[model samples]
Target: MGRNTRKRRTPLAAKVVAGAAALAVGGGGLVWANFHASAHEEGPAHHRTRSAAAQVATIDCPDVGQQLSGVPDRARGEVDGELATMDSQITEAYQRLATTRRAQAGDPRFVQNTILGPLKDRRKAIIDRIQLEIDRAGGRADDNLDQLAGCQGRPAEQPQNGDGQDGGGQDGDQNQDDNGNGAAGPVADDFIDINDVQPNSRASENGLAANGDGGSTGTFTTDCGVNENNLFNSDNLIAAPGVDNGAHHVHDYVGNQDNDAFSSDEDLANADTSCRNQGDRSTYYWPVLRLQDGTEEFDANELGGGAEGNVGRILKPAQAELKFVGNQQGDVVAMPKFLRIITGDAKSFTNGDANANSSWSCTGFEDRQVTDKYPLCPEGSQVVRTSNFQSCWDGQNIDSANHRDHMAFVQEDGGCPNGFQAIPQLQVRLVYDIPTPTVENGQVRNPYAVDSFPEQLHKPITDHNDFINVMDEDLMNEVVDCINSGEDCQ
Candidate 1:
């Protein structure tokens, strides 16, 4: 029990520490192992300049093994079902390859590619295959849960059974069922299937309006009106809810091409359209995810969860990503990137934090013209996937919501009454994601396991379960609380 409690808290605790004051240190210890360090400083030559960790602190390297202990609450039985389905898909692909080989059994042309051919070129396919195990130790529905006869089931016969809900004779893990109230009997993880809640989990740790992890069931409210359509399947909340309160953020622009959801056929079929962007170009898409979808309940995450149905549903990514839209302007082709800015006392800029480039002084906090913020911008520093920032905020209060995170010049475009800018300065950061109570190679010998249970299920990512010794509150808070606050960063 003591161990389980510690394990449960470890991931989140690490998150807190990560957000508060994580910095890249010079020497090696536990900190050096996990965090990727950078020695970059913001400068005046926008081209030769760099982006530093600023305004609010951020961590790109994540240690979520602890927090990922349980199954996602969104789709309890979907794990088993999902795994089963994935196996089938893999089988289908294999069959296709096999058929291709049979047709050209002897022809050298048939030997067009080698064994790793399909896999090597299809990074997307390969990534999709292992995405679940990599991101949060989370898996999507293999669809065998409720499959009928002749239909296959999970290959491991595992995946979603961690919670015991599938009744595969697995151990029951839920102390409380999906509703937050105690269940009449023992339960397993995956009791609920909302993406917001960890898979295989029966309890609720994050604050949500309703339990369901915002399932496809209930009547959720949005300024747009009653969302009976169950957009993201958020049981109680409406899709794009709270947009009126400024909770609305640009997730992604969907267009006919990659961003197909943005403009309709009308936008693409214009007669006198000569100049413009992708949509203006009339060949691709430019849709963006609203802030609601970007955070809280992203459609596409490492685990391959989020979003329901097979329609042309727009998915919100779990992490904020770097989008490179090929653009053709007056005479050149370019990609647009929203750069991070600085926010510290006179700018001694902190190191680009959490393996991400940082910024300071809120310099470029409000600017529409980004032509000059380019050139070396991509290589000047590093890139950070910010989808986490969406969930970090308190929503009700923009000024204070997840205020600990350094706001980007893009998010804080105008409102720079407090003084912000991009300047030349050095950015320092603590090593990212070093476990609290850092672990050593031989600390516990086989310290990776939480107990016999989890290890048997899967090999632990870190040294040991529930063994974060370096997690001191003050130190952790300092890291999280420090990013982008415009204070003394270094």
Candidate 2:
């Protein structure tokens, strides 16, 4: 059977529990819901229970990388390195916060005074170095960057019983573990039964209206085995080139085999590809999914794994579908070689949902999708993650200082913004066969979560995908021609 076409489970009478107070997060922000009846599962292995009282949730800080613009090419590498260092600093602080519950209970200001204060100082120093790098390269740096160094603690979910006490019930340094075991995240509250979600309508083609003869309605599918070659890494060359473990979590790579922190354009163009079509050497990657079931994977003791709070048995996708579709308004242009695109915000848990584009659902229930919460699929169903990349290019630069300004999502009318050209949009769909997590006593056991920055708490909202177009000029032209001619070519 195809991965997306899984057998459907027999329909059981919906189980609705009354008088349950749950933590619900929406596109705007966090919302607390006291519902008279909510949907849940009805089996011994799957029970929807209240989430544990929020632990030391996450650290919230301004995104310095998003604030930078107009950086000179000469200083980009050094500035990127400094940004990666800042990310590491936050990870270290979060690790300390996760393990210091006793100190937190003893002093209300312990996190502020001990963690945030010192973190801010370190970040300020790093920010100054970034400014110096830019200034030395004959470019002007933002003088107000130091103001973004300070961070604050965001409280986790409150207890549903109105007890106003921290959950986990630990004392004297026996704090919560970093993995999916209560402290780090993917708590019971982070999941919702997929059947409970109402079917919501979305744009027919992710905002691309493929009507009228003027639009490009074709698609090009590439068969790249889902990381079967085991190309996994913790580096993100686009965001933090030349820095090791820049992603802070392991990613599953599919296309380019030579991708790493130090890969150059020439290296990627000449590298081997997992794609069946050797002409298509583009790289497609995203954070790996893991079952927090205490099973140690190969990276269990590595920096981006157990040591960095991302412990669990990694789960490979049963299917990774990569397809490039055409523009809805006009014929799509060939993407410049080595064009880099990031689809979603990797820090949406703390950065809010402005750039969040996570779409999660079950094999049988594709009509309903969730952004912030992990879906608890019923028996016989599999989990699915979908990402649609921005398709409008600036027609000049392959990348931008902030890594996002060079591309834009299609406008509501399916037209590119001024000075931008329409390019083929990439849509990635990954399917996984994970066991449903059991929730009891306000805690999650064997919960599956996406790898994320430690401070992001492995929230589903932080799920994202990355792509670097490495197709040779001939293959790209063929893709454009196939798309414009309205033919589904593979």
Candidate 3:
């Protein structure tokens, strides 16, 4: 006499975040793939909590009595302004892409960050960085954008209340005495959109393009005269080799997948799976920043003294776990805060994996609710788990069944209680700013713009067919000379 009950699984990005402790054990970037452990493996809720790791890395949360830097109003203004500018830049890039082949809509020459990373990551980073700078200058002592723009030495604001309180202005009686001056924390070198672009990242040099500006990592083409149905008619597989041999896919998007019948047939099936994985499912995770003196106050800031040392909570590690979801080795699963399930470095550019930094897709087996109360989270930015289903634990039994509670969030909790959903473009820019690891190297890379790219396009921009793979300088020069001499060409 047993009842038939079925509970859905959670995604890997939704899994508990792995802290520095786990990282110390030589664990790669967090993922619930076969490469990583599952929630049920054997650890307790607090097993791999990140607080200790954050502390060890000198990335501590702001405690009481600590002063925040930068002026809130100024920081907001700067971030908003930068976003507006980036929005325009992103648009311009898209327009350029449009002029290319229809298949080029997804071209890296046009954009990757805009398409790959979520829009919010870019937007938030810009504003946050600006605010960080404003805070560093004692909240109102900033010199210029140059000093402000650099992502280094940013602290929260320190207010001197009258009667010699903090933020009590220059040379105040009691205010000057309590202020413990320390150099601002170091800022990330640049902004990067993890989605479509990799930016200023070591990953980019390995073959990933920081953005469309750098170059294409790969390319996909759309054959003319093909609707969703006739996609594989050789004529339909855009620049396909030899008639596409009657190849096609369910969803037009076949990442750098090969053009073959099985690939085509399996594509639709996989696409169906990808979309199925997201049905009525949304992720919840908070992007917390250390509030400090002079730091900009927003949603979390209103709570009072939440800013950090000119540094706001920048890296939001919360994302879904890929294992619980149906994502597979090659497919991608999107998680809130720009977290996605990706394979390890095994798939490098050298191996034809463009974003050699980290393979972009997560393993498909371990999808479970990262938190029991994920169902209670509202749909919007700053989505945090609603329960105590904490971080990863090794050698423990993670009951994936607990995730059933998350479905309730889809019905309740509410969507963006702020009811604020930026147009696709703005959403992309805002998220990349700060408290979100927006900087890749030392530049800005937006992801929202990709929505503007026609869905017809596939793949990235880079072309490596017969590319010279020589390591020696003189040998490379000789090879280039031979090619230039036209022996091969002739």
Best by the TM-score measure: 2
lDDT for each of the candidates? 0.19, 0.73, 0.20
* Alpha carbon RMSD to native, model 1: 25.8
Candidate 2 lands at a TM-score of 0.85
Models, CA RMSD each = 25.8, 11.5, 27.7
lDDT of 3 by residue, 40-120 (tens): 212343333322111111111111101222334324223323333333222222222212212222232212233223323
For model 1, residues 281-370, the per-residue Cα lDDT tens digits are 222111121211112333321111111100112333222111111001111111111111112211011211221222111112211111
Q: Give residue 40's error in model 3 in angstroms.
A: 35
* lDDT (Cα, tens digit) per residue for candidate 2, span 47-148: 222322333456788899989998888888778778887887777676666545546656767777898999899899989999999999999999999899
Ranking by lDDT: 2, 3, 1
Q: Considering summed lDDT, which 10 consecutive residues are worst modelled in model 1?
A: 460-469
